[model samples]
Target chain A: MAVFVDLNISHTVDKKRLQNIIETAAHLGYSTVAINHVVDLQQKKQEIGKPKCVSELFDQFPIVQGKSRPIKVLNRLTLVVSEASHFRPTNEFKSYDVVAVFPKTEKLFHAACMSFDVDIICIAVTEKQPFYFKRPPVNGAIDRGVFFEISYVPAIKDSTMRRYTISNSLSLMETCKGKNVIVSSGAEKPLELRGPYDIANLGLLFGLSEGDAKAAVSTNCRAVLLHGETRKTALGIIHTMKKIEPTAERREEEEAPVLKRARTEAV
Target chain B: MVRFKSRYLLCELCVSDQSSLQLLDDRAVFTGVRGAVCRAHGDYGAALCSVSFAVKYLNADTGVVFLRCRKSHYRILWSALPFITHLENRGQKVPCAFNCLYVGGTIRTCQKFLIRYNIQQLHRMLPHCHNEAERLEVRRAVLNCSLKSLEKEEEEDE
Candidate 1:
C-alpha cells in the first residue's frame, strides 16, 4: 500500500500544540507529515529564514497507526509569491525538505506552473479564486510533475470557505483532469486534521475519480516528496553517497590472496 | 423477486472525552449524518440519502453505530461521514468524529465483522494487561462473544 502523507501542517510557535497535531496525525495513520513555514513576500521586510531541525521537535516520534513505524516529519517552506521578483532561490531553501508556492496573481500562477522550482502550487481556498485555472498552465504543471494542492481545513471550518474550496478545486480538476493533484490538510489544530481515507473520500467531492482521489493523498504525495528531493539534487536521477575507506583487515585479506597464489605457483 | 439491497456502515465515534459518547443517540447521529450529507453533496445527496436511511443500532459504551442506507446511495453517506465534526444533543454540541470500521451489504454481515473487530481489539489489548485478573477479564470477554455468536448461529440453523 502507498503510505499516506500530509504535506502541509501549518507551522506554529507553540511547541506543545505542534506536537499535539503531529501526534493526532500519527494516530490518524499518516505515515509522513510536513510542517509548513509560509513566507509571503507581499509584506514588507519579508525574508526567508532557516527552518528548525525536524529531529529537535520530538525525542521519540509517535508511531503511525497500523504501520508499526515512527512517523517521518519533514520541514516545508511555502512561498506566497505575488510578484516575479518576490521569490529568490537562496541557501535557506535547501534546509527544508519540500518547497511550495502560493501564487496570488494569474501571471505568477502561470510562472509557477510552467517553470517555478517548487513541488506544490496551493489553490486558494479562503476566498474566491480571482483567476480561472487556464488549461495550458494547468497542463504544463501536470506534464512537469508539479502537483496542485488543495487544502480542506478551510472547508471544514466554515460553509463559505467550503464553497470556495470545492469550487476552486473543481475548476482545477477540470483543467488538470485529475492528474498531478494532491489533497492535504493545511491544519492548524489537531481537530482540523482528517484521516487519510477521509481525505481520499473528500477528494471525490472535489471532482477527482475514485482511483485519483486515493492517489491525491498517497501516491501523489509521494511524488511530491520525490520532486522536493530532486530540487536539492542534480535532476533527481543522480545521487552521490559518501565512499567508505578500506580497513586494515581488508588490506590483509587482499595481500593474503596474492600471497596464496604465489605460494601455490612455487609449490 | 429481486429484493432491495442496502448497505450497513459500521462506524466508531471518536471523541476527546469518553463521557461525550453518552450524549450521542440514534437521533443525533442520524441528523448529523443527514446534515453532513446535505453539506457535502448538496440537495441531490440529501434527497438520495433521505430514502431508506436509518440508524439501526447505537452502543454508547462502545461508541459503535450501525447506519443503514440504500446500496445505490451508500457512497453518498460514506463520503459524508468524515464531515460530521460534532453532534448536537439537547442544545449542547458534543465534538466527535466518525471512524468508519466496515461497510457490508447486510446487517448480519456487519454484525459478524463488528464481533471479529472487537475480538481483534481485545487481543491487541491483551499484551497491555498489567495483572492476571485483567488478562482473564479480556479472555472472558472474548470467549463470551464467540459463545454468543455460536448460540445465534445454532438458533438460526434450527
Candidate 2:
C-alpha cells in the first residue's frame, strides 16, 4: 500500500512547535509531510526567499507509526498569486521540493490550471470560491498532473469555513470528478492534524467515491510529489546525475590486476 | 431467519495530556460521536447512527473504546469519527481525537484483534522499560493474557 503523505503542514517560525507538529504527524501515521511557506504577492514588498534547510528542524526525525522508518520532511513553497505578474518562476522556487499556487482571480486560476509550473493548486477553503471550476480548466489541470489541495484545518476551526470547504470541494469534484485532488491538514497546531484514514473518510464528505476518497490521501499525493520532482528534471521520464569519480588508490589497485591479466594473456 | 449484523469500531482517544483521558465516559463519547455525525452527514446520518448505536466498552485508563453500530450505517459513523475533535463532559471540553484502530463485524473478532494488538504494544513497550521491575511487569502482563486466552480456548473445546 502507498504510504500516507500530508503535503501541507503550515509553516511556523516557532521551532519547538513545528517539531511538535511533525512528531504528532509521525505518531498519526503520516510517512511524509511538507512544511508550506506561503508568499502572498498581493502584499507589497513580498519577495520569494529560499526555504530553510529542512534538516535543521529535527535532530532525529520521529519514526512513522507502523512504518518502522523515520518520517520524511520536505519544504514546499505556495505562492498566493492575485495577478498574472505575481507569479514569476525564479531560482528560489527550485529550492523547495514542491511548489504550489493559490489563485485569487478567474484568469489567474485558469493560468494556474493550464500553464502554471506548480504541483498543487490551493482551492479556497476559508472563503467561498469566487469563480466556478469550469470543466475545461479543471480537466486541463488533471491532465497536466496539477493537483487541487483542500485544507481541512479551516473546516475544523469554524462552521462557516466548513460550509465553504465542502461546497468548493464538491464543485471542484463536479468538474474534475475527484481526480488529482489532495486533502491536506494545513495544520499549524498539532490538534488540527487528522490521521490519513480520517481524511480519506472526510473525502467522502467532499463528494469523492470510496476509492477516490482514499486516493485523495495516498496515491494522488504521491503523484503530486512526482509532479513536483518533474519540475526539476527534463520531463520526469529522463533523469541524469553526475557520476562519482573513483579515487586514485582504488583505480591504481584495480587497473594493475587488469593490466597484469592482459600481459599474461599476451605472453 | 434473517439476523442483524453489527460493526464494532475499536478506537483510541488520543489526548495531548494523558490525564484528560480519565474524564471521558462512554456517554460523553457517544454524544460526541452523535453530534459529529449530525454535523458531517447531517440529519440522515444522525438518524442512522441512532439505530443500534452504542458504546460497548470504554477503558478510561488506556483510552480505548469500542463503539457498536449497525453494519449498514457503520460507514456514516466511521467517517464522522474524525470530526469528533473533543468530547464535552460536565461543561468542560476534554480535547481529544478518536483514532479508529479496527472495524470488525463482531465483538468477538474485535476482542481477539485487541488482544493481539495489546501484545504487540507490550512487545514495543518491553524495550522502553527503565528498570528490571518494569520489564518483568510487562513480561508478566504478556504471559497472563496468553494464558487466559489458552484457558478460554480449552473451555470452548469441551
**Which model scores highest in TM-score?**
2
Can you tell me which runs of candidate 2 are displaced by over 4 Å?
A237-267, B122-158
Question: Model 1 off-target regions past 4 Å?
Answer: A238-267, B115-158
Please give me the total number of clashing residue pairs in predicted model 1: 0
Model 2 RMSD, rounded to 1 decimal: 8.2
lDDT of 1 by residue, A9-61 (tens): 99999999999899888877899999999998999998788989889999989
**How does chain A of candidate 2 score by TM-score against the true chain A?**
0.89
Per-candidate interface DockQ score: 0.32, 0.41
- What is the Cα-based lDDT of residue A139 in candidate 1? 88
Worst 10 residues of 2 chain B by lDDT: B149-158
**Total backbone collisions for each predicted model:** 0, 0
